[model samples]
Target: MSVFVASLAFGVISASVLAIASIGFTLQFAVTNVLNLAYAAVMTASAYVAYEVNQAGVVVWVSALVGAAVGATMSYLLNRVVYTPFQRRKASPITLVIVSLGMTLIIEFGTQAFVGGTNVSYTMANGPTLGVGSFVFTGAELGIVAVAVATMVAVHVLIRYTRLGKAMRAAAANRDLARVCGIRTARVVTVTWILSGAVCGLAGVVFGMNAGSFGATSTDIFVVLILAAVFLGGPGEPYGAMVGALVIGLGTEVSAAFIQPDYKDVIAFVILLVMLVARPTGLLGART
Candidate 1:
């Protein structure tokens, strides 16, 4: 029972980080209608930025801030310079996905060329571990979870309360209608990119802190897992993403307790497949 509890806590912690990353990815997809394959590269890029900031004697939170800034900026730039132009040319969904894949490869290879193909660690500014029942977590881990929950709440509030958020939803629902409604669809799209980027960066930093260290491949795999969670939860459903990520995180960790740790990934993926088979639209997605 203790082991079970331990696994459950671990799963929640994992879900927390995954939620941040997937939320960003899902938000971008919701607004832009593109499943960005290059998102992992952005996460890795932000993690490296955080590492460099920490190495320069900045605090961990400061590093995270810097990372978030980079992510937000990068996403804006990508949209302004690449996607926007492609969109102007009336790119199709498949074309956007392919373009994102190309972007992903370029970013990954660029990182490898610049940073070298190697793993790096960002040790959590060492602190005491807190335990609840059989679950153990460090101050840094809890901080990560807090940040995720806070970000999600913030997003919910923004969408529910703010004018800008309403504009974003309008654009997502129907770009032409949003434009007709004078919602500034282009600007909203830009804001969506920036917001998505910042969360992605935060996700990268928090996950790096939580897991100790990672290389490009590790981060990329994590991004893929996040995408799966987002898809399972329903791409445009923010709260649904949280639920799906939590389910995947728990399923993976608990399964790992009895099976080879390596198979844990397979378990999460299998669940995603099963979910897709049962409901093609996703747990909370529209049937469109």
Candidate 2:
């Protein structure tokens, strides 16, 4: 029972991190119409930035913020430098996807060049564990959950109540229509990249925190799960992504209590396959 409950607790934490990363991924795809394979690379780069900041004696939270800044900047630059140029040339979505894959390789190798393919640990101070019944969490884990929830709420409010949010939705639904409606789609796209990239960085930091250590390929490996959640929830649906993350996160961890730990990722892959076969549009995704 304790093991089960512990798995549940860990699942919730994993879900939160997954939610953060998945949301960013969905947002990028929604607004840009590009399946950004490089998003994982962006996360890894941000993790390294956070590591360097932490090594410089900065607090963990502050380092995470710095990582977010770096992510935002990198995302924006990539759009302007790589994506935009190709877009101007009327590149197909498939072409864009291929380009993103190329970017992923470049970023991954670039990270390897600088970090030397070695694992690095963050200097985080441990705190007391908090438990309720059989479930337990550390201070950092609780903080990750809190931040994830807060970020979700903020995103919801922005989308539902703000002008920019509406523009984002409009842009996502139909970019040409949004422009015809007098929306500055260019500006909207820029903001989407920045916001999504910020979340990407935050997720990367929390992911590293949860794992205690990471390497250049750490985020790339995790991207498989993130991609599963994104596809499971609906590619461009943020709320759907959240639900999918929760389901995948809990399912993977809880299943481990009965099966081998190494098979956990297999569960996510199976779920993703089932979802695809049952409903390719996803549980909460809208058909275009």
Q: For each candidate, what is the lDDT? A: 0.85, 0.90
lDDT of 1 by residue, 1-288 (tens): 466778888898899999999889888888877788888888888888898888888888889999999889888888888788888899997898899888888877887787788888874565778877666788887888889889899989988899988888888899899999888888888889999999988888888887788776567678778878998998887877888899899999989888999999899999999999998788989976
User: Model 1, residue 154: displacement in angstroms?
Assistant: 0.8
RMSD of 2: 1.2
Q: Quote each prediction's TM-score.
A: 0.96, 0.97
Query: What shift in Å separates residue 123 of candidate 2 from its native position after superposition?
Result: 0.8
Which candidate gets the maximum lDDT versus the true structure?
2
lDDT of 2: 0.90
Tell me the spans in candidate 2 whose CA falls farther than 4 Å from its real position.
none
- Positional deviation of 219 in candidate 1, in angstroms? 1.9
Please state every model's RMSD to the true fold in angstroms. 1.4, 1.2
